[model samples]
Target: MKLYHSTASPYVRKVLMTAWECGLASRIELLPASGTPAAPNRDMAARNPLMKIPTLIRDDGSELYDSIVICEYFDSLAGGTLFPPAGEARWQVLRRHALVDGLLDSALAVRYETVARPEPLRWQEWIDGHSAKIDNALDALEREVDALPAAFQIDQIALVAALGYLDFRFASRPWRPGRPKLERWFARLSERESAKRTVPT
Candidate 1:
């Protein structure tokens, strides 16, 4: 299997972490794909219609796009380790994943709005909207993060990656305030081998 991945992408890190957690990291090849997102190379487009990073092309010529889907596939291949087996616990996990995913998306949008656009074209309003989502999501997660289990899963993986990305790209925004549990949780997750290996440069 070949994975079209970027070293600095949080979304891509989710899939990589999933593979590592599932003990399938060695089976896939990571390929660096360079191009503006608007005009990604044809090869990437072939694997993923969106021409996005973290696209997984399996040995059988099958492909999976999006980090969530890729993580699910990895967990399936590993006989269900990355996600919960079933029931309300599963829904909570999915909800946590969504929260982290939303935070990442918002952070990415704020980044592109600032760096990719001309100064005059920059939109603080748009940036603020997403930034607000990140803030509120952190607040919500911090409120209940302590209740979650200690073991790793896709939801926890994504939550940690999202918080790590904020520290990566938005250090100006401090989310550790009044959120001791969430901060401690993230601090612990940071010690994981997967996180140490995949930390954004």
Candidate 2:
């Protein structure tokens, strides 16, 4: 199996963490990718039409894109440890995963606007909107920190990945001011083998 990856991509980090937790990391080879919306890499486009990092090529020559799908695929290959199979537990995990993933999306948008766009072309309103989304999501996560599953599940993985991205790109706008619980949780999670190994370069 091959994984098209980027060290700075939170989405790619999530997939890499999933692979490590699922005990499939050793079976996969990482292929550094330079694909972006503004300038897509031909090699990555051939494997994933969306030209996204964290694209997976399975043993049978099939490809999988999107962090969530790739994580689920890894979970399946590991005999379903990362996700609950059914019922309310499954729903809760999925909901938290979605929320954190949304937060990551907003954070990435803010990053692109502030860092990638030309100074005159950048819109303050768009940046503010995305930052607000990230702030609200962090608040929600802080409030629900106690309720977060004790196990290192997909939800936890996604949340950590989102936080990692914020640290990587939005270091000037610290996220730990009022979210002590979430901050502590992240600190502890960061010590885990997967988190320690996959920290964005």
TM-scores, each model vs. reference? 0.94, 0.97
State the lDDT at 39 in candidate 2.
Answer: 70
lDDT of residue 99 for candidate 2: 92
lDDT of 2 at 110: 83
User: What would the TM-score be for candidate 1 when compared with the true structure?
Assistant: 0.94
In model 1, the runs with Cα more than 4 Å from the true position are: 35-42
Local error of candidate 1 at 72, Å? 1.0
List residue ranges in candidate 2 displaced over 4 A. none
